[model samples]
Target: MLAKRIQPMVSQARRLYVELMFQVMGRALQAVSEVDDAVKKETQALPAGFLFEMMVMPNGPRLIVEHTGLGRLHYHGASAPRPVDLSIQFKHIAHAFLVLSFQEKTAVAFANDRMLVDGDISYAVRMTRVLNRLESFILPKLIAERAVKEYPSNLHLPHKLISAVRIYLKVATNFVETVRA
Candidate 1:
């Protein structure tokens, strides 16, 4: 009985965390694309109206973000009925948080059997590149280096710092809007 009672609370917390991860990631992607031409170019080949999601297992929590042209990435509301083109589902909530917290790279996590991908492999690879670009902009150099396979040698610190601030500001604004809505 105690286990049953605690399970729901744990599930709720995991769902909230997963939702927050998506919100921050969506804003970071938008911010990076705005300031980095390389990132914009990387996303150019993605099919328009592509919807992607990272979800926790067993109906725990899901976040959907859509890629529109010109760096406009928007978080699709939980209630939105759009079909996801690419869905990365974590086998467990803890594993999902591990990737979100940067302790595990997405590719590494996938390779380690921590998650499942339900979509086109080619598109998923493209999306991974986009995500690596966003991490370069938002994460600290030390963390980004570990999270990405190859941290660019020419990525200047000052530029990265400036972009990080912009990404954080956008994420905060998005968070506020989400809370208000």
Candidate 2:
């Protein structure tokens, strides 16, 4: 009986955690596009107004990022008002939680058939590269190494530290603006 009751609570908590992770990731991507040259260059490769979405199937948390002109990105919250250029949908919330929590690398999740991708494969690849770069900026080296396919060897400590600080500051400011709006 206790196991049955606890299961629901655990599932709900996982859902909430996934939702929060999506939000933070959206903000972090936005920060990365604005502050990281490599990310900006990647975004520039995407067409202006391009929208990319990542979500869990059956109405779970969603994140949408748009490639605004001028090599910038905008986080459009959990919904897409317009059709997205690329959409990555996890088969279940558990799969999404696993990937978001760094228990699974994205390629591993894809290999395990944990998610589905819609739209251009090339665009998805580009977005993955951007996400990897963004992760390197925001996550600790140890965690980032696990989250990304490979930690960038060229990113020396000083550069990583400075970029991380700037990106985090942008994320905070974006969060405040989001709360206000």
Q: Which ten residues in a row have the lowest lDDT in candidate 2?
A: 34-43
Clashes of each: 0, 0
- The best candidate by TM-score is 2
Candidate 1, which segments miss by more than 4 Å at Cα?
1-15
lDDT of 2 by residue, 1-181 (tens): 9999899999999999999999989999988888888888878988999999999997889999999987799999998979998999999999998888998988888889999989998989899999889888888989888888888899988999999999889889989988898
TM-score of 2: 0.97
lDDT of 1 at 107: 78
Candidate 1 residue pairs in backbone clash? none
Q: Which stretches of candidate 2 lie over 4 Å from their true place?
A: none
Q: How does candidate 1 score on lDDT?
A: 0.78
TM-score of model 1 vs. true structure = 0.83
- Can you write out model 1's per-residue Cα lDDT over 1-181, one digit (the tens) per residue? 9999999998788667777777677667766766677877877777778888877787857767677876556667553457788987899888887888788888799899998889998877877888888887788889997788788788899988887888788778877886898
* Top lDDT prediction, candidate number: 2
| Cα RMSDs, all models | 2.9, 0.9
